[model samples]
Target: MPDHQQRIAYLLARYVNKTCSREELEELFAMIGQENGPDIPGDLLEEIWHTAHPAPDIDYEQAYLHIKPVVPIRRSLPFRKIAVAASVLLLAGAGYWWLSAEKKTAQITTVQSAPAPPILPAGNKAVLTLADGSTVTLDSAGNQVISQGKVAIRQSNGQLLYAGQPTDGSIHYNKLTTPRGGQFRLVLPDGTKVWLNSASMLRYPTVFSGKERIVELDGQGYFEVAPDAQHPFKVKVHDIEVQVLGTTFDIMAYRDEQSVNTTLLTGSIRVNKGSVQQLLQPGQQAVANNQDQQLAVRAADLRKVTAWKNGMFVFNDMALPAILREVARWYDVDIVYNTSPATELYGGGIGRDLQLADVLALLEGNGLNHFRIEGRKVIVLP
Candidate 1:
């Protein structure tokens, strides 16, 4: 008899190869359903990433997006590795990480896939509101430079960039907003790079000057702050402030989310909430709980935190409700739950470039829940 690990490995290989019998598929899912899932090694994951090739249908760039879940999720399964396998083999035409493809890829979802219009994924779309209150539709602007007062803002290749302008001390504010099902990138006057996620907003000055550089954030963004030790950079999110000299970090502060999370990738930062302050090192995260009005620090999940910027929807041990919120933002859909979901922390991810039906298929094959789509509304089923 094979050991548990050996059996899992065998079943997974067979599943990928589309050679699994119904019984074997049931057994495989049952094993994963146990209290604790398999423990795969990190090196093996790296090996899979380095050697695996995508199926013929998927292009190299598309497969690369799915294969790049670098950080481990906070779950029993090091599903980050499985995500690699899923991307190369399954998500090319089938499921997320685990599923019985409906066809050669092993059809898996319980969601009704009758002929219907598909909801496409988000792209480089944002509305830039200049200091003069004039708005430029960035997605259609292509590569163009628009002048706002004395500053010249450049929009190209889905990015908004501008060279550092000398401030006349007039201090005008410009806002960048990513609508639902849209995202955008920006290069601030000081060379700081900002990746705005879906339904997020960032407000900044026309140029860097005075004692410090500051920006206000309303939803989510990943920041690679330009190094300026003399002039610290600070991000204002509600009541919390993340202050740093030069560092790469991500912040999630959606109005619907329960907590405001700040994950630091490189360099050090100080997170201040009123009088309470916490210093964070690289690979650390500061979480501000809205309900209790408290702040705490812990090790960060870099992959999960910055997955949006990387072009994957990686979720680890997240509940259905929370995951749907992400889906709603990126796909611009409403979630209507006909059945309350089990409180299990499911983990998996797919390339964000895929459509809504593809994403739901990936999630449904996990054996936790399924979905039904009505127009722009996603009806969650048990």
Candidate 2:
């Protein structure tokens, strides 16, 4: 078997033995249904079954055949990967599927999908505001290069790239803004890459002429800075500034959010806010409180922090209001609450590419609250 398949087999064994870690379980779910991979062999499946059951009388072939007729696995499974993994666990007699058919039926009967509002996912859309006050609509702009003195700006393959160095010593700044329900990627002149989330703005100079390269951000952005020991890259988000020589990090500093977060993925970063400064290693996060002007550093779940860039919404004990705030930005919808919900925390991962109705449906299935979508507004009811 291939190395990846072998790894998967090993993971399956660990899973059946109830020894798989949360990260390993997530990896196993991600690998399911991956294309160009061989189907799990029967021998491995049998081993997994016996590891979980530990009974010699329970025949794997008979159990699989019995479930095959009832489950009906066609050429393609008409279910999400999480759902499939749940089914597999149930087949192994680990436990009942978390999303059982009875619960789904009850949810369907209570919530009607046809009348809900339909909001499409965000796309590669942003507006470039030049230094001269002229604007370029990136989504509608064709494959054409615009020149600002010696600097060349162009959009290709859904990414905005900057090439050619500035001739003169003068620096001209440009701004890229992504409205609600939009996102964009940009390549700075120093070969650094940035991913801008919805309702965010980035302001940067056309060239790096000074001792330090600095950029200002209004909302959230992920940075893959190019290595330059002499000229460190700095991102200023509101009151906090993140300094790095060459590192990958994400900064969340939305005006509406109470705190500014800087999560370091690779390399190291120095976060500064007022007189407070914190150095972050890999898998660490620095949070700056807007009101108290205090900086706190803690270990971070990198997957949850960077999930937005990977086309998913990952929550780790996230509050209801916080999740709704993200949903509002991504779907470009206003949220109205009839009654304030109790302090509720949720943890899960869902595809950000799904439609707003689909995402809301998943939330509604929990039966904790009701949602009514009217046009571009999502009304929350207790």
Best by TM-score: 1
Across residues 133-199, which tens digit of lDDT does each residue of candidate 2 receive?
9998887345778888888999876689998887667889999999999999999999999999999
Q: Which ten-residue region of model 1 has the weakest summed lDDT?
A: 100-109
lDDT of 1: 0.76
How close is every model to the real structure, measured as TM-score? 0.82, 0.73
Cα lDDT computed for each candidate against the true fold: 0.76, 0.75
Quote the lDDT for 235 in model 1.
99
What is the lDDT, from 0 to 100, of the residue 193 in candidate 1? 97
- Candidate 1 lDDT at 163 equals 61
lDDT of 1 by residue, 240-319 (tens): 99999999999999989999999999999999998999999999999999987699998876777888898887776678
Model 1 spans > 4 angstroms off: 1-14, 21-23, 36-114, 164-168
